[model samples]
Target: MHNFLRFFPVFASTLGVVLAVPLNVSHTTISPAPSPTCTEATTTALPPEQDCFYVPPNGWETKEPGAVLRHRFAPQQPFATDTVNYPAWNILYRTTDSNGDPTYAVTTAFAPKDISTPHAMVSFQFNYNSADVNESPSYGIYHDIKPKLWISKYLQHGWFVNLPDFEGPLAAFGAGHMAGYATLDSVRATLKMSQIIGMPRGADQGVRYAMYGYSGGAFATGWAAELQPTYAPDLHFEAAGLGGLFPNGTATLEKLSKLQMSNWAWSSNLRSVMIGLGTMHKKIREVITSSLGKPEWDWNTVIRRLPQEKEVSRLDLKNAVNTAINSPLVRNVLDYDTTLGSHGIPTMPLMFHRADTDQLSAPEDTQELKNVYCNSGASVFLHVHPNTWDDPHFREGLQACLSEDIQTFLATAFARRLYPGCGTDNRPWGDHQYGPIGAR
Candidate 1:
């Protein structure tokens, strides 16, 4: 094992004031179980204490991806799912970072009331697309557009739901591979811990699972789906529901770049993509810093100095985005950092939705992705919705998939009643509705 303690301090110092994340380096790892109200350390400021940990047990990676390093119940607050009659388990499981290096991630599991009830597990990845560690799902912090209410419908159906902090420890926003790896591992951990967490006695006849996500979360879902065949052959997701997917890093940037070939002129998510990639690849970081440099608050120095969990305002980032747009070397650097089509094709049944009004990524990107997957004999159903939600295209696309239709789609999949759309490319967008899908 790499001397984690030897590098732990450096990791803490580099991120500036934030404590190091848990690492399960080996199968023999063990640590004193910590209380949910872990004494907040003095250094864990920018991020809330829940997101930071004093070093986890020595084991960083298990021989198996989903091996659980620790399991405990969440405190009597947000995770206190008891009000809804759902008991929650907070888990630390082995996973890999964007670079494919070993690490550990946190996932929260809420089992159904009749623990032994035959239920499918839902690996519901959320769109916590920010640098804030406190924003990680394990922290139980809810953004305004949070999908808990929609997820609640699943809970009401007695389905098991697992919410993973799939971005890895660094909150890598658009880091697809790492997100996918974490999603798979989180499922593994949740499934293995079901008995201890209280599953109904006989439901374990191989609990089937599926993945659901949108926007940034879809980045994880798409990557996770693509990687599952190779990185997690044991995982067999019955269905995957992806929305607002920004699959190709380059295509997404171009669509969002004000200075690039874009129909929408002012989206700066390219900066977020760069920041996320920087967390994994040093070369990418170097290119980002060179183009977006401003000694007083350059991308590198600011990132190196500030706590990653804190919000970086738009005004604070205008200079960097502008610099990247005006500089060819900087813009070209991102050309090499792509996400779509890199991971192998996923064989799971898939439902991909995008808003016709989405300005963040061109519709052609999804079409291209559908073609790629079909060429590999994968079943993919692509849908492009009309702008029903008047919000920004990105937000509209996000809400598009999280609607009642998605919940019904998931529930149907869990019940084993879903059939493939028999589509090789984009399927016609289903009509909008206020009721459960297909409820004529």
Candidate 2:
């Protein structure tokens, strides 16, 4: 989730910004696109101007979100049936105001493309916004770009992609539970949009609705899956996939300070810790005020107070928690017995992929998640990679594995009661009841 590589130039005594260009071609081969009716479907009542959508007052359909605003270049290959990869008339909208809660918008490459019925729809949970001022160029590389890439791939399969700005009005980072609800509602809004447009979404027939996310996405996915059974029971989802899960935020703070990735992790952890402490514990407000020499704090105010590298070096996280514990504002919640207090249970199937060598998120902690839901009797699969450290977070391989596994699992998990390929041996994967392989 954290990119430690950004700091390399500081030690090398050179200063320059390096642009990351995606591979000229995607390495992972994708499935072919399905045919659609010749008649074009139309978009329904458009969302207000502020929201992200297909037909905003001004929008670009070809470029992905977080991309440098620039002229579009034609893709070398043609989309199926000569459909434009970046259609000229399609609209891309952004919605921030959803009454009071935080919300964001997303539109596909071809909004009005013909699809009589959709097989699945995926809504993404965006990570934190590190950029200081709204509309200013992002200070850090925009990591929320993955969802756009994923949406491109899903569109090839005729599935709709939904992107949600989970940060609400204040852009709440580390507010895991609230982020979850916002993500779910965004999906609901998309479904409502589909209905309004007369597009058929197989949500009632249990159309395979899968939730896929990485890191910040993982947190949103975890909370969404946990809350869906109760919150959005009418919406049918087959599976939920998560990778680079920073699930136990409290535990992660305790473990990651000494890791090689600490340089990057510290910033995210500090932001999340402060936000979580402030949002979850009422008493924490008083302590932070007394210790930091401030009268009150808001999201932006607290984020600005975050320590720089040198100051953070002198501070210890566990000790900080102790101080927070004594703070009149956070004492009660901090003193509350367990790390992850009893929360809602997840009703749908779950797929978690983790690499053994992950520095940002421990694989062991991820494996333990299966045990948490084992009693509920839901279908769960835990895929463990052989400690690959390709990504700074040690999660790139794990993210791919989770994506592939979830795709295969949902295709077969419910109807056939079958699991996809799994295990180090590369043998066939069986249902949860049978495990990946049978020795007999």
Question: What are the runs in model 2 whose C-alpha is more than 4 Å off?
Answer: 1-118, 129-144, 195-198, 202-207, 259-262, 276-283, 289-300, 307-322, 325-341, 388-392, 397-406, 410-440
Residues 198-254 of candidate 1 have per-residue lDDT tens digits of 654353466778888877777788888988999999877888988877766765654
Can you give the lDDT of residue 377 in candidate 2? 57
Q: What TM-score does model 1 achieve against the real structure?
A: 0.76
**Shift in Å, residue 172, candidate 1:** 1.6
Candidate 1 residues lying further than 4 Å off, grouped into runs, are: 1-54, 77-83, 114-118, 142-145, 200-204, 259-271, 295-300, 304-338, 388-402, 424-440
Overall local distance difference test of candidate 1: 0.61
The lowest-lDDT stretch of 10 consecutive residues in candidate 2 is 23-32
Write one digit per residue (lDDT tens) for candidate 2, span 1-440. 12333456472222111111111111111111112222222232221222222122334333332222221111221132344452311222222321223233332222324441435555544343322212111101122233334445555555555555454333344555555666676566555555443345553743345677766667778877876776667666766777667666655655544431344444444544454445433445556544444456553455455434333332444455546545443543432311221355566666765555655566656656666665555556665555434443433432352234444544443343544323322122222222542111
lDDT value, residue 292 of candidate 2: 49
Query: Could you give me the TM-score of model 2 versus the true structure?
Result: 0.62
